[model samples]
Target: MMIGLHSAPFLAMVAFVVATLVRGMAIRRATGDRPWAFASAKGVQRIAGSSFALCVAALLVAAALAPANGTNLAVLAAIVSLAGAAIVIVAQMQMGRAWRVGVREGDAPLFVSHGLFRFSRNPIFVGMMLVGLSAAIVSDTWWSWSALVLFVLSCIVQVRIEEAHLEASFGDAYRAFCRQVPRWLGLARSA
Candidate 1:
């Protein structure tokens, strides 16, 4: 088990899970007085996206351990995943308590477009995408490819839902931010 931990796909999955757990704890602690500050972004879209992501993670593990997988790429995958994990950490830190798992409703009025949020509307999700890509590279299997495909498709839907929510919730402010910042990264067109 200890040796298996070094496998790239497993490590990537673990890193993603651990980072999320830490973020959850941070959210709980930060929201001690104002619990409504956080919420489940849960919705039909989110549920479907989350299901695909979970499936990918599970399938990647099995693929990574299979005999066809090689060690040479594992280290590279591990490095990429670590970098992605680092991004997740930074994004979560920036959000602090502002991070919610899904679209928030009622009361919370803050729109964060500073820090890493300025670079990417969904930094955490971007980082997770990196993690998924790393898993695919490490496993180099059809299963892992399926996982990556599912994750990418999920992100497309998730982003649409989230952007719609942000637009509705923050109105002009969010639209301005949208104009200012590219959805993933790079410079946004000026409004």
Candidate 2:
């Protein structure tokens, strides 16, 4: 059966929204803080999160509804998504205390540079990108691809904002870490 966007995309969209909202809320509740700062440079984090959710949804829709002919693209996307998820989970686990949805100015309960963090500065984002890409590939639609692009853009902007906040909070420590680690990508030694 040839699945199309009409049916699958909507379901994916719903799932994405629910997942993000639930996750965001959990993060908020766990951290006891909001993720957004109203006075700051707008709501980049919110926007980015929203964009990522939408893109992921679209990709999921495509994957489910589209026929599985075992295309190379779909296979690759699946691998990427699975790998990314694993990496992100490891990173999240390592960053137990420091894992908050929004920025925190004070000293983080923990400064994790272990596990996946030792490899990639932003393993979560990398995982997210892989998931987003997988969705696009699974969907095999222009819209899915577009979502991938938007997701990347959102991550880029959000990362910069996050970096500024982290630098302010961590000062030289963060600067030194940045010097050692790449922003989105990871080096071989750590991986």
Candidate 3:
């Protein structure tokens, strides 16, 4: 049975997945290098990345299985999810060739601190969290909420790893940028 076919949550999740895949494909086509690194990760990175990917899948499953609700709240959540998906694509584009799924050994992309990065050091992750939150809201299911929580936790671990890599690679420049931009999003400090 095609349950929850018309649910906004399911639609939003689909949209986010489509946007991410399309953008990733475009980036890969533009550059010869593969942008994906989940499969190549090891140790903690491997665990976190795999966990995040699984959470995304769990959210998709939960959304599809949840009961359909066409309330205004669902529509709002869909809109928010769409915005989040857009943010992911836009931030990725802003990073341009610098965008990557995970850290690569000796693969030093440019230190991006403009566009969406100026507002949030981790805009891509922020957008992902938005998608997870919206999926939970639209689905209104225990499974969806649990998936969202796991998604957030996984992101936290992954972000810390990426941040450390950036700091080591970019040194003072990365630290200065971190000081100017909040981890997520907020008013920039004047200093």
Q: TM-score, each model?
A: 0.80, 0.74, 0.89
Residue 31 of model 2, lDDT score = 80
**Alpha carbon lDDT of each predicted model:** 0.69, 0.63, 0.80
Candidate No. with top lDDT: 3
- Stretches > 4 Å off in candidate 3: 1-6
User: By how many angstroms RMSD does model 3 differ from the true structure?
Assistant: 2.4
Candidate 2 residue-pair clash tally: 1
lDDT of 1 by residue, 48-150 (tens): 5566558655645753573433476766776777777788778877876666665555634466777888788888888877878777776667877776887
Clashing pairs in 1: 41-102, 41-103
Candidate number achieving the greatest TM-score relative to the actual structure: 3
What is the per-residue lDDT of model 3 for residues 7-112, given as tens digits with 9 covering 90 to 100?
5556666876776677678878988767777668899999998999899999888767665666776777777777777788788789887877877666667778
1-191 in candidate 2: lDDT tens per residue?
A: 55433233333334444544565567678887553342233366667667655666666666566556566665566566666666656666666657655454563554566777766788877876776666666666787788779878877877776788888877888887887787777673431
What is the full ranking by TM-score, best candidate first? 3, 1, 2
Q: Model 1 segments beyond 4 Å from truth?
A: 1-6, 33-43, 59-72, 107-109, 188-191
User: 2 or 3: which has the higher lDDT?
Assistant: 3
How much is 110 displaced in model 1, in angstroms? 2.0
Candidate 1 lDDT trough over 10 residues, lowest sum:
33-42
Ranking by lDDT: 3, 1, 2
